[model samples]
Target: MTPPTGTPRPAQAAEAPARGSRLRKATALGLAAGLAATGIALSTEMTAGAAAQGSLPAGTQLYKDPNSQVVRWVAAHPGDSRQPIIARRIASQPQAVWFSNYSPSTVTNDVKAVTTAAAAGGQVPVLAVYEIPNRDCGGASAGGAPDLASYDAWVRNFAAGLGSGQSIVILEPDSIALTTCLSAQQQSDRFASLSRAGAAIHAAAPHAKVYMDGGHSAWNSAPEQASRLRTAGILTSADGLFTNVSNFNTTANEVNFAKNVLAALGNPGNLHAVVDTSRNGNGPAGGGAWCDPSGRAIGAYPTTNTGDPAIDAFLWVKPPGEADGCAGPAGTFLPDVAYALASAGASDPTTPPPTTAPPTTTPPTTAPPTTAPPTTAPPTTAPPTTAPPTGAACSVSYKIASAWSGGFTTDVTVRNTGSAAVNGWSLKWAFPGDQQITSAWNAKTTQSGANVTATDLGYNAAVPVGGSTGFGFQGTGSNTASPTAFTLNGTVCTVS
Candidate 1:
């Protein structure tokens, strides 16, 4: 795998938009309100300004991808203190803006600001419908939508702000699978709200595609989740089901599990999936906990160029820098930790944080090698039917709510939502309208015509079941329109 060459964040000026643009949305979701392609869109101004900000960037794919043995080696041996920033630089991907931790009104403005910026930058923005009732399902990060009416209203407001096009929405976490945690009545209420939310988004922004959460592979099996989605009116109301948001499952496992879920959903032509590549570099292991787990680097960001049929693009839905509960509080931001994460390439921290000090303070010979086991697994349910094969005509029949930073990276992430492993994988696409590939990671990439593709190597072949690998890279560009169409393994991952 190649190493990343992306630079560090530059000092910011006042966050403002030029001519005819809306003032920057001061909401937590605000920034360019403009998201990026490959689903890794973020607001640098938001992240930089906050005492503790949590957001992934456009080329987060490259920053998060662990495609570099060189960077990995340097990271593994942080010999001196300078390595943290070096690690951050080494881990650098295209950055994004954020707007989390805002009040309802602020969220509205945040969304609007980012959207405006995205339009100005011509980049697509990544929107997460996190305000669901009992959102965390009472888990550690357990806090979300308090009521259906309010939840629906929030989604409605969010939907209303979709500026023109080039936006991706990852709606609700633990909304579907955690149904078991709630009463039948409660589940019904939330699903009804989600159904309404999906419909509203589609209606308000027909150009914007909204995806429902499918949980992670560890939580729900495809068929089971499919049943939940069907009940939630996924087939009829939303674009398709989403998996691995805010969790650390591998892309391979997510791919297989998603394919199974789609199969259970009658494999509708309007179905597809998005994998959360914010983390999961080594794939989830050592019991499923999402707290900046050990050995977890970044996974693939958004991409229309995946080599699968059933999957659309792998996205960084869970804003990377945010804490996954367990640490301090859920969704809260911690900059020192962020700096540490940036430095060590922030793979999952399997054991708890060191009590006394960082490993560097202690003697190297005394320190334990800090690698954690993986946490990959198959879908929780048995497939009712055989899953789709690798590169086969994917049954993806949904519009991709995507984010992109132009082209491929060395350290990339790919999942096999289809039944079989991709015999070989190559993501290729031409720049749409004003967009272009700025950088890539985790894999070698090449561009011809408008077509650009990233090819995986032996170490990163056929994403293992429910497993995700992150790669990194660097490039140059300016345009920012989310790719509308993509082909996985030659077959198109299209909206029905």
Candidate 2:
């Protein structure tokens, strides 16, 4: 991700607008206010059965695709060590399907299949419409329908597949956030195209909740993003805004950021927000490195029960384990990376609710405290007995992820195996060969001779029992023997 310019704070925008624009804004404001105050049911024309199944009602189950990349990988490698955890944590969750390819002819059927299945299962499906021209600003995820006209046609065809079911459409990630790459005319053309795209989707499937990109918490200021969104016609064309798509920013920050953007957009109570919580469990890496940074983990599961009324749901807009072009080719799924993210997130179940609303799902069971020995005899006869403190224990897996002639990259996974949670951690190990550390991500590393130490950053400091976290580094040396031992907080750990 580009370096953050500011936090999600409100800024000013002029009230000036043309007459037509003023009328449209006023109408939207009344519609939103009426929906909130009266709890009025959405009309059949306004929403397909989507209000019940597609709008992600509280405690609603999101559709889990049986043929997702992670599911196929899990089925193929049933015996892999990471299979169980990945299958349970990553594959089982509902995530968005991207219609990123610019095939107008087949896009309809491809989308229909997913929506059809979700409709049959009485679940909501999240779809990401990303075929905008010059997508990603000519970065790794570049290329789209060539121009605005073709993009409008493609989006119309894509909308045909909503299948009268409940669906959430995340329209063109990075479309607004990365618009800096376009010239003034290009930007206007793109915005017009986006506005048309939203109109087309709603025209075809009024039930589909179309959310425009509000960028992430760290990128554009709230007012600037709101201004861009306004120009793109978010207030009329889309249901709300989505933040942190495929980016690792904290849900808390994204929530605050999204609220700020909504306020700047006029704060119609009906225009809600959803956060991409797929890979933000540990928040952003230090320095805001966006490309496949290590130690990152999965955020909250896909749930519509976001305690906050302003926030609608925590959606997994970006599938987990997809490389951001650093660890591998962009969009490539790496099982090892997926395992680390799941393992790191699996242990901690106490994710604070986004607001004061009580948790929807029951919390994980906690270990009961040990009972002290019965004091049958007088204290003078025997000293009062007490339970021993639980010591930290963990297992370390060291893998050489990639290698070359003079240098190689490695990923080390540390899993908590103790009965108690690890509040903070420090991993120390000695290299078997003359490998000198060059640089690292996820952890702060310092090497002396063959010995190396990696400590947790601010976000990744805690390790609940059975939870895992990982860090990676690049080094120079011919010798690449895996370290045989590791220590977490001074306690020796089993090697994998």
Candidate 3:
């Protein structure tokens, strides 16, 4: 999922008059402290379920919609080297159907197609209703219905397609969280529209569950955000709020912040929330580096059984592999990034953990008798001419171009020290910790276990003696150390 274009502002100093706001502020502070201490604990609960049921949670009724861009990519590019990994890691997983376009003529039919299929399959489909006026504050993901009346008509058409089936509707991304840029009147109008949209969807499909947007934890203070949610009619218009859609905040932090927000709303009818755990395996990188930053890993697989009562489900709201504007055009699917996210070893059981063996004890051994041999004469014939070097002896240099909390971008240079040229080369290294490559350029890269291998692209394979070639990558981890060792064609290289 692409992050909103406008940057999140600091929390305003103006205090909310509601007593509930004061209580929520105090509770959120405590939860934030706990999140800081624990960080993100690796959980296998969701992974185990996905593996058993071919990527869907076992015994869960959430729909695994067959229509997704990644699924289509896999079908079209069967011969691409990255196809299998992308298919296994992302295409197989369930994600939301995003209706970003404003097509009044076909919107109803499009929504009906997905809901009808899922209903027949005895499952619930997730719909991301993103056509809000002035969406993303007229930034990158901008464009929605022209005005309030148009938006109301659009929502009506979209809801008509629900077909009385179970559906989870994500109202709009960045509509509430990024409202500081809007005027007071505009903000009020937007909130009213959201409330009406939720009511419209429910009227069409009584079984539908609508979750309004609540941005990520990093964007707004919990009390302020809770106040906004309450004003948006969260109590009567929707089931609950959803957080971290197309953002990188960790689940632990989002869960804590969400609970605080709900508590501030006085837990209206014991309302709960769902989290977008699409690409937050490593959590947010510091400094708001949101547009296609490198090093991000896919988070937990989508599952209805999220273990936490307040958290209804962990859904993949933003599909992996889609660029957030910088890597490619915004929303374009890049297979290289998809493969990197999949191979990052977050939930991959095929990646073996580092092992430790017991130390071995050696028995005593006697030294052989020292015997002095007679001197030998020089060889009669001259030594055969030394053979020419056959392969390149390469060395690699790594540098951190930029870094944030959970992710960083790096540049790697491969130099040939040998006398001969290398027609083809494969550079390999093993991460010292949980670091994983999320995106790469100038070369093709793959990962297994802690090891990463980058093969030269067709245009840059050959490296002449004393010449060099290079590639770049983005990965996730904090305080990442340089790779301990590097090898070229199985031969160890000197790291610098």
Candidate 4:
């Protein structure tokens, strides 16, 4: 999913293939499976537990792959300050690992290794097959096989790696949802490739459940997404659909949206859905804060225990704490952000909060900003120095809007208190405790250990004398003390 504002959309392509004869064969196999398909069978034994409506499904079985980056990090950094919380909140959970590279030669072996390990552990592996041409519309996660034939070849090899074990494949993200960016012919060819992909996977591993990308709750209307799913051969080529991968939308919202889309698809009660409940704990931050906005928390943990009959499971398609191309590169893991998300107790899995109030049960609408009177402060007359510049005279104020057990929301305002106008600014501070910023808005923010820098966006770069601009962030930690010192362009700002 695309970020709200200047954040670049992560490129979402990976490698797969298409051979005319093989495509025909795979498509035929998928069609046959669809005609003879019965709905998934539920195990008779269910673990008795009270799961939140859209949280992990009770009695559902999901596999936790041990090799995920977060899992490895927790093992290697057991002594780190953030390790304990991250290990408890994130590393322990199961998430899908993406195979985005187009390595035809090694793709099959890679798939086999994963599936083989999962089978030995009596678990089902979740695999994300992300290669598709022109993925992300040439955005940040871009790079796929050169053409359809190459993609077809890649898929065939990828499918071969399934090794007759239980697996779940999340087919290309944005491949269908973002098709409007493609020409009509491109769309048609892409759809065909997707169909071929599903067919190939099903043919290779009959036990593998394949889910096509359904965008997210906010992107396409049910009917529209359903139509696209049909055109992409979901019914004939795949088992079900998945949504909210790499995006933040409340699970409740995705549940409703997924059900509506399935209803629109008119499947005969066979198709189900999975939601990426990785980092939607506080839902979207509104105003298009898709790319790692502050104060966002981790959502429900991975589980097959979705209470809803129509929903299959809630999976962590996008691993928590991984940068979505803004804080870092698209998939680079950020420990502080991860810690903030995992520790955000706004929607604790044990006591999941209602995403929205009764009746609608959608994400709560963000409130309009309330204007506050300017604070009275003493002005400084320090001359602006270009080099070794002594600090610029400014005022900084911090406010905690909300707090939970491990999470809090803070807003910081900076005003030019000097006589001269400030052309550009950088606000810096350090957390007093283990606190980490998960998401931020109104500026470009980055964190290194406890220190953070919030740089002005173009529109907010210039602060005339007495003018002010502000940004907000959501963070996680037991201690949320206001940073004692604030700096603006090397000058210490008086805190209010």
lDDT agreement with native, every candidate: 0.47, 0.67, 0.64, 0.66
lDDT of 1: 0.47
Model 3 lDDT tens row, 112-153: 888888889898888777777877665546567899889988
Question: What's model 4's TM-score?
Answer: 0.64
Off by over 4 Å in 1: 1-102, 332-496
The TM-score obtained by model 2 is 0.64
How displaced is residue 199 in candidate 1, in Å? 0.8
What's each prediction's TM-score?
0.52, 0.64, 0.64, 0.64
Residues 309-414, model 1: lDDT tens digits: 6776677555444444322233333332233334434342322332323445321211111111111121233222233365454322222222235522122234
- Residue 234 displacement (Å), model 4: 0.7
Q: Show model 4 residue runs off by greater than 4 Å.
A: 1-60, 346-496
Error of 4 at 340 (Å): 0.8
lDDT of 3 at 103: 78
Candidate 2 yields a Cα-based lDDT of: 0.67
Report the C-alpha displacement of residue 92, candidate 3, in angstroms. Answer: 1.0
lDDT of 4 by residue, 1-496 (tens): 3211111112122211110000000001022223213222221211111011222235645666676667777778755666766777777677776777667888888788778888887778788877787776665565667899999889989989897766888898778777545765576678767877887777777677888978787777777777777767776677788988877788999999998999998854658889988878788765545655556788887878777778888898777766665444456555656766775735444524323222222211221121111111111222232432333589998988767789776778898887777876778889889998766655556789999988754435577778788767667899988899988888888998
lDDT of candidate 3 vs native?
A: 0.64
Clashes of each: 102, 1, 4, 28
Model 3, total clashes: 4
